[model samples]
Target: MGHERVHLLKKIQEVEFAAVELQLFLDTHPQDQRALMEFNHYSRELMMLKQQFEMQYGPLLNFGFSPSQYPWRWIEGPWPWERQY
Candidate 1:
């Protein structure tokens, strides 16, 4: 993979972990304002990261392509099992 792809992948993985961490914190301390803030922040970051990844590499989820793309370019990337993250 190129440097851009590697960087994006690393960033996406980092954001995913941040989301998971926030979820775990919120699970035990559901009313904590700081945890809630962090959760929202990470969630937004994840969305932006996913969008950038799709715009560059291909859709990681379903909504990014059009009917004109036919079979969908989303499937072009590494499959679920093929992905490490």
Candidate 2:
């Protein structure tokens, strides 16, 4: 579980980074269709990965980024930085 969680989180981070980079590129090049397509693709991919992560483990973020279960899940351990690959 721990190893899988770490791997999944890494994927999420990588996709998110790509999305953000594409967004920045688009900001200066709005006419670039390829960049826009890639940005949207990464955005959707990031959302799916995040959902999978939260469901299998717990909410990946707080302050409305991800919802908690009956009790707050934001406080659980093995947080992103604490996980070992």
Candidate 3:
């Protein structure tokens, strides 16, 4: 809800988009090492951002993803559809 949270979410979206695009490229050009490296870099960035967001805000997923804190904090935050972005 805050500006910082919004910015981080935007960054995560951007990195995820890049990763998807690189994946598509690699699907056709499987031997392109450069694309593979770029995909890995973006994947790493996305993972870090997701971890940071989860630590500060809450789990971004409902199950089988980020570890929940004590008292089950995953259900404590706003649902994705309820958020204003």
The TM-scores of all predictions, comma-separated, are 0.76, 0.91, 0.89
lDDT of each: 0.74, 0.87, 0.84
Best by lDDT: 2
* Model 2 clashing residue pairs (backbone): none
Residue lDDT tens for model 3, 1-85: 6778778788888899999999999999999999999999999999999999888888887768778878788777465335464
CA displacement after TM-score superposition, residue 3 of candidate 2 (Å)? 1.0
Task: Write the residue-wise lDDT of candidate 2 on 1-85 in tens digits.
Answer: 4778888988998999999999999999999999999999999999999999888889877778788786777788778667565
On lDDT, who's better, 1 or 2?
Answer: 2
Indicate which candidate wins on TM-score: 2
Instruction: Using lDDT, rank the candidates from best to worst.
Output: 2, 3, 1
Q: Candidate 1 lDDT, tens digit per residue, 9-67?
A: 78888999999998998999999998899899999998888777766666665553422
lDDT score, residue 17, model 3?
Answer: 100
Task: Give the candidates in order of TM-score, highest first.
Answer: 2, 3, 1
Better of 1 and 2 by TM-score: 2
**Clashes (candidate 2):** 0
- Candidate 1: RMSD to truth: 3.9
